[model samples]
Target: MHWFLAVERRLTRTALELAIIAMALVVALTFYQVVTRFVLGHPSAWSEVAARSAMIWMVFLGLAAAFRMGSMIAVDLLVDLSPPAMRRIVHMIVGVASLVFLAILIWYGTAMALRVRSQNLAGMSITIAWVYAALPAGSALALFGVIARMMEVWREPAGAHDDELKNVEGSV
Candidate 1:
């Protein structure tokens, strides 16, 4: 159990780091685009599309990172009032349901990305599949996060120190 937890923690940490890097890249690209467009008087044709696409990826990755940290948004007024044991059950059920939903998203998103593989974006000559790819990739990461979280919930000991609340914010 300790070993498993160590692995999960490492995985979550890695996701968080990757999300931070993606966010940084997006900001840098946007800044670069603005500077080049106004200061240099030469706007990039693909910068707009690239920046927008990067934002999409950033959002999705951030969602998965949030899930890993147990920071996904939730209305827990009722749960807060419930008995501790019951609250654990509720959390377990919700986490499993989320896993199911993410599975479906992974299925549909992968199909969608593949279906548009040959198509190109209207403005940017890049393949549409590249844009759609973020959906499935993000969903897959989120699914793994959900499963990891559910396992932790299921095997968790009584009075366990759980720090899952710090990771939930605005996710995709």
Candidate 2:
């Protein structure tokens, strides 16, 4: 279990790096688009499509990192109010439900990616499927994050702070 956790952490870190790079690329591309359109009086068609594509990848990749870091929003008031025993039960239930939801996303996302494989983006030569592929890829990464989080939750005591709000409050 510990080894699995270590691997998940490494994978999550790599995903975070990729997401950062994608986000940076999106910003750069958008900036270039703005400068060319307004300053140069000539906009490149490819810049808009490229920026959008990068943004899609960034969003999806960031999802896994956010999940792994427990940075997502959640209604944890009820869980925190529950008894220790019940709290653990609720955590397990939430974990299982999250896994199920991610699994569905992976399944449908893969189907959609395949369906659009032959279709190209409107202003680019790249296949639309490549953009769609981010969906399943992110969902798969999120599945691992869910499992890793479940393991952490199981190892810790009940009523522990496992969401972002608690961390923010503690820092303040």
Candidate 3:
């Protein structure tokens, strides 16, 4: 169990680092686009598309990081008010539901990405499938995050405040 958690933590950290890099690329590309279009009066056609693609990757990868950190929005008041026994059940149900939803995203997103693998982005040589791949990749990461959270919940005692506090801190 400890080894599994360590792996998950490492994976999440890697995703986060990649997302940060993507975000930086997006910012740089966008700045370049603006400067070239306005200041230089010669816009690079590929810059906007490249920035948009990077933004998409950044958003998707960031989603998994947020999910793993318990930063996703949720109405937890009901769970908090429930009895300790019921709270565990509710948490399990929520985790299962999230897994199911992410699984669907992974399935359909991968299919769509493959379907469009031959298509290239306008004004760029890159394949559109690479951008689309972020959908399934992010969903798979989120699925792992959900499973890890469920395992943590099962391992901890009911009514444990650590996870709750972390969630609360993340929200704020």
TM-score of each candidate? 0.80, 0.88, 0.89
Off by over 4 Å in 1: 1-7, 75-78, 158-172
CA RMSD, predictions in order: 3.9, 3.4, 2.7
lDDT of 1 by residue, 95-172 (tens): 877788878877888999999989987677789888788887877777767777667666766425244433323222
Identify the superior model by lDDT, candidate 2 or candidate 3. Answer: 3
lDDT of candidate 3 over 48-167, digit per residue (tens): 999999998998887777767555447276576778778777778888988888888889989999999999999988889999999999888777677777787777787784466366
Q: Count clashes in each candidate, considering only residues at least 3 apart in sequence or on different chains.
A: 3, 0, 0
How much lDDT does each candidate structure score? 0.70, 0.80, 0.80
> Candidate 1 versus the native: TM-score?
0.80
Error of 1 at 154 (Å): 1.9
| Residue 107, candidate 3: C-alpha displacement in angstroms | 0.5
Error of 3 at 134 (Å): 0.1
So what's the TM-score on candidate 3?
0.89
